[model samples]
Target: MPEIINISDAEDPRVAPYRDVRERDLVGREGLFIAEGEVVLRGLLDSSGHRPLSLLIAEKRIGGLADLLERVPADVPVYAAGQAVMDAIAGFPMHRGILGLGARAPGVAAADLLAGLPARALVMVLVGIANHDNVGGLFRNAAAFGVDAVLLDTTSCDPLYRKAIRVSVGAALQVPFARLGAGEDALDVLEAAGFTSFALTPSGTLALAQVRRPARTAVLFGAEGPGLPAEIMARCAGVRIQMSAGFDSLNVATSSGIVLHHLAEAIA
Candidate 1:
């Protein structure tokens, strides 16, 4: 069992990492990330890709989380605080009263992640997806469909963002992801790995359902309004979801789920 420390003061130096979360979230957490709520914390404990540094919980909630706490590594510090102190430390009311500070495992290059995949594989590539909620939703969908991995362009938001982790219900922690190095082209990597890349776009030349699933498939999604760039789509096979007359596109996250579901069914 991990040691449980009691925190009476919000400013206690030991708990400084959890202080002013909102402010730190804007500025970035150095190498650490905040995992919020019971579900995300549970995900943290279960994930091998992230290491939990510490946990902060409301004193009242400790009994309920005893079994969950047992899974935490012996050396990790677990801190308990009253609701008021918790709120003060976080600079907001933490109703669920569970927060974890975690560090991501050492970075894996995009090429390495792709090379490690089995012969038959499915992956998602995200480009310029800045919205945290959308990024989270994409991971949740990717996990649901058993995607081999997710590759993000450098412009995308961090999946480890607190809100993204909460939004994904911890799927972000479970899924393997790597961002492209600056100036690296996503298609070049996929193509070199023998993946048939499909760019999802409103003006795609072929309907998504028409294309046969490839042994190694990589689906590319871009930001909602702009969708995938024409140049990028030109390099990959353009695929579209059939929609009503007036609607040219769907929300990026929603579109990802639909596309992933189709591909998953094909694989099944």
Candidate 2:
């Protein structure tokens, strides 16, 4: 077990990194990745590319964290504090009772990712997605649906943002993502990789069940309001989910789940 430093004061400089977590997203430019709950923490630890920098646990919850503490390197700091102090330091109620700070995996080049991609790969390309939760949910869905990789467009939000990482349930750490340089948009990059681009849109020309599966299928999606850029949509095969009326569109993440699930099943 790692040495458990008892924290009595919220102002302790040693724990300052955990303060005002809500605002940390704005004040911190380099971005911070957080893994909450025992399940997510274990998942992050299992990943080869991610490592925890430190951990904070409510005094009452320390017992449940024994397995995690045992797995993490002894050098990693594991601190214990009362509920009040934990709440004050985190700037909110710490329901999970345990949180881990992990290093963000460095961004990779899109070309490099695709070059090594396997046959029958399913890739998710998110474009102009601004919402952190949606991005996180999309990552979760991508993981669930067996998407081999994720590619982010120039306008997408940072997937490693603290909130995003928390919502992804550590799936963000598990998924391999790379960004394209220059004008190589998500659709263009997929095309270059011999992947057939499938855009998820309400006004899409083909329904989800109608499209033929390609050996490599890269699904492109965007945020709710604007949907995918018109130019980007022009480059891919347009497809829509079969949905009921009264609902204009699903949240980008929800739409992604449906598309990825069906596509993954098709591929399988």
Candidate 3:
């Protein structure tokens, strides 16, 4: 069994890092990512890119994590506390008794990421996607549909955000991503990387079925309400899914799934 530290006081400085758990992003500290639920926690620990600093396991549910506990590094701290105390620390209930703390891996630069990628790759790029859950789902869908990487453009939420990590079910931990600060810069970077960027838009002139699937493709999606910026879409190749005219556009993540699925098939 891993060494367990019994935590009694929620205000203890030793547990300070875990305090005000509900509003963690507002904590002002950088590079911290939280994983909740045993499945996601285990995924983070097992993934090569992520390393957990510690874990807060509910004392009542330790029995459920016997196998995972055995696999955790002996040196990693396991803070065990009663349900009420755990609730107090996290500022909520129903965490499934397993939360892991880990330092986020340093972000990879877009240039370096492109240099390291295989000659032919498929990347999913998010444009102005603000919802963390939607961003997380996009990562999950990208991973599932054979996207080689995820790129974030202006206004997109951080994929490593705590809610994003949990919402992605840890897929964010495993998927490769890099943030591009501006839309113009993102397009230039993709071009320099030898990637053909495709913007998915409802008003796109070409149907998705007609576009040439390149050996290297980057698919870009924006949020639902505003959709892709007209200026941004003008700078890249454009394609839209053929759906019923009366039906509104798909959610950004779902559109990404559709694009990635087709791209995966094209690549295969």
Candidate 4:
């Protein structure tokens, strides 16, 4: 069993990092992110790419985590408190009662991530997607469809944000991702790496049923309203999801799921 240091005061310095989590959140904590709930915590524990720094768990729920705690490093701190105290620290209801502080190497360059992919690969590229919920949902879909990695343009939001991690059920940690710098040509990078790129949009010239899955594919999606930039779409093969005549629009996440599922079926 991991050592459980009982914390009664919400102001305790040891648990300070977890305070005001929802409103203020732990910012600039040197790449550390809060993994909440049993599912997210389990993902943190299972992931080798990211490491849990410590844990802040509700005292009443400690028994439920015995098997999980065994996998945690012995040196990491496990701070336990009552539900009320946990609620006070989080500045929220604290219903989930489980949280882990974890870290991963931050700011992986898109080129470095692309260079490491296998010859036959599937990548989901995001351009100008700033919403945390959408970012999380994309990662979830990417993982579900066996995407090799997700590449985000400089305008995209960080998937490590607390809300995003929670919303993704921790897939942001499970699915590998790297962010591109400003002016970086992600399609050119993928093309040079031998990937045929597809731009998904409602106005796409090619029908979804006409797509020929490539050995290595990179599917690009943009933020909902603006969608993919015309120049970028023009550079890649454009494919559209067939939808009801009146409803050409779909949530970005929903559209990604539909497209990825179709592509996944053609995987060799």
Which candidate leads the pack in TM-score? 1
Q: What C-alpha lDDT, on a 0 to 100 scale, does residue 38 get in candidate 2? A: 81
| lDDT tens readout by residue for model 1, 1-268 | 6679999999999999999887876885778999998988988898978999999999999999989899999889999999999999999998989999999978899999999999999999999999999999999999999998999999899999988888899989988999999988999999899999999988889898887789999999999887878889889889889999985658898999999999998862
Model 2 ranges off by over 4 Å: none
Q: Is candidate 3 or candidate 4 better by lDDT?
A: 4
Quote each prediction's TM-score: 0.97, 0.93, 0.93, 0.96
Model 4 lDDT per residue over 1-268, tens place: 9889999999999988788888544456568788899999998888858889889999999998899889889988999999999999988999999989888856677778878888888999999999999998998898888999999988888888998888888899898888877777998888888889999988888887788788899999999999989889889988899989987779998999999998998764
TM-score of model 2 relative to the true fold? 0.93
lDDT of 2 by residue, 132-188 (tens): 999999999998988889999877887777778778887888889986665776666
Instruction: Give all candidates' CA lDDT scores.
Output: 0.91, 0.83, 0.83, 0.88
Cα lDDT tens digits, model 3, 59-158, are 9888878899998888889999898888888888846887888887787888778777898898888888999989988988877887878888858888
Q: List the residue pairs that clash in candidate 4.
A: none
TM-score result, candidate 1: 0.97
Q: Each candidate: RMSD to true structure? A: 1.2, 1.8, 1.9, 1.4
Q: Which portions of model 4 miss their true places by more than 4 Å? A: 25-29
Instruction: Score candidate 4 by lDDT.
Output: 0.88
What's each prediction's clash count? 0, 0, 0, 0
